[model samples]
Target: MKTYDSISAYIEACPAEHRTLLEQLRAIIQKNVPTAQETISYGIPTFKLRGNLIHFGLAKKHIGLYPGAAAVEAFKEALGAYKTSKGAIQLPLEEELPIGLIEDILRFSVAAQTKSA
Candidate 1:
């Protein structure tokens, strides 16, 4: 696997089409928790504030946001519009990105991580 020293490097590695989405997602997470450290975890862009708060990546047709297992469960209703699994929600590339919802999830995730810590 490739190793990156920073978030900018990781974002650079992504395809050009994914750049905007990645940047948008990165901005939201950073805005909510500026102290969070960015890293490439499990081959995707991950953020760590108090702990492993969230990880996101570009899929063939969507962006996959992994906000931990608990966050996925808590927001399952809101996430129903997308394809999801135990820890990820697939936001389709062709659709308008749900920035607000993503922010809420990130905020909740940061709080959850803090509580567990």
Candidate 2:
């Protein structure tokens, strides 16, 4: 599997169509969690504040957002329209990226991590 040293490198390697979406998602994460450290974890771009805040990556036909199980459950209603598993949400490439929802999730993650820390 390919490995990435940084988030930018990971985004750079993605297909052009997905690149813009990933960049926007990265920006949303950064704007919401200004102090979180960015790194590659489990082969995906991850944000760490008190701990693992969130992770995101390009999927075959969607962008996968990993915010852990609790966060997924907490936002279940808001996430109903998307595909979700235990700790991941798949935002389809064809749809307009949910910037507001992504921002809310990032904020929720930051708050949750901060409280547990």
Candidate 3:
């Protein structure tokens, strides 16, 4: 598998159609967590504040947002429309990206990370 050196590179490596959506997600994360550090972790884009805040990547049919299990559980009710696993949430590309929900998730992640730190 190919490895990306940065978030922009990772986003660029994805299919052309997914670029805009990935960029939009990146912007939402950045906007919500202004002080978080951006890096390529596990070959995907990750944000870190006190520690890892969130990671996001493009999938075949959706965008995967990894805010860890606690955040996923915390927002379970709000995320009922999307497919979620232990630590990830799948935001389908065909539907409108839930920017508000994404922002809320990011904020919750930042707060949780901060509290833990």
Candidate 4:
């Protein structure tokens, strides 16, 4: 496994095809959560506010999003088109990114993290 010190480093290491998508995603995340700290956690680009807020990464065929298990379940219906696990959602690379859904999930993560902290 590799290590990354920053979000740009992680995105730069992704495949060229996914680089732009990841950059756009990162921009949306930053625009939505301006106060969240950006860092590499668990070898992925993670955002932290009260704690860990959300994570995103480019994989072979998809973009993986980690907003924790609770957020996944909360937005299960809206995420029907994507492949989701207990704690991660796989957004397909060929399709357009669901920016609105992602922002809603981020809001859920922020609210939950804030309450716990």
lDDT of 3 at 100: 90
Query: What TM-score does candidate 1 get on C-alpha atoms?
Result: 0.91
lDDT of 4 by residue, 23-77 (tens): 9999888998999999999899999898888898878899999999999999999
Model 3 clash pairs are: none
TM for candidate 3 is 0.96
Local error of candidate 2 at residue 72 (angstroms): 0.7
TM-score of each: 0.91, 0.96, 0.96, 0.95
Q: List the candidates ranked by TM-score, beginning with the highest.
A: 2, 3, 4, 1
Off by over 4 Å in 4: none
Candidate 1 whole-model C-alpha lDDT, 0 to 1: 0.85
Give the alpha carbon lDDT tens digit for every residue of 1-117 in model 2: 899999999999998878888998898888888899999999999999988889998889899899999889999999999999999999999988888988888888888877877
Overall lDDT per candidate, in order of appearance: 0.85, 0.90, 0.89, 0.90
Error of 4 at 1 (Å): 0.8
Instruction: Tell me which residue pairs clash in candidate 4.
Output: none
Query: For residues 1-94, could you state the per-residue lDDT of candidate 1 as single tens digits?
Result: 7777777888898789778888988998899889999888887788888768899877788888888788989998988788889988988988
Candidate 3: global Cα-lDDT?
Answer: 0.89
lDDT value, residue 34 of candidate 1: 92
Per candidate, the number of residue pairs that clash is 0, 0, 0, 0
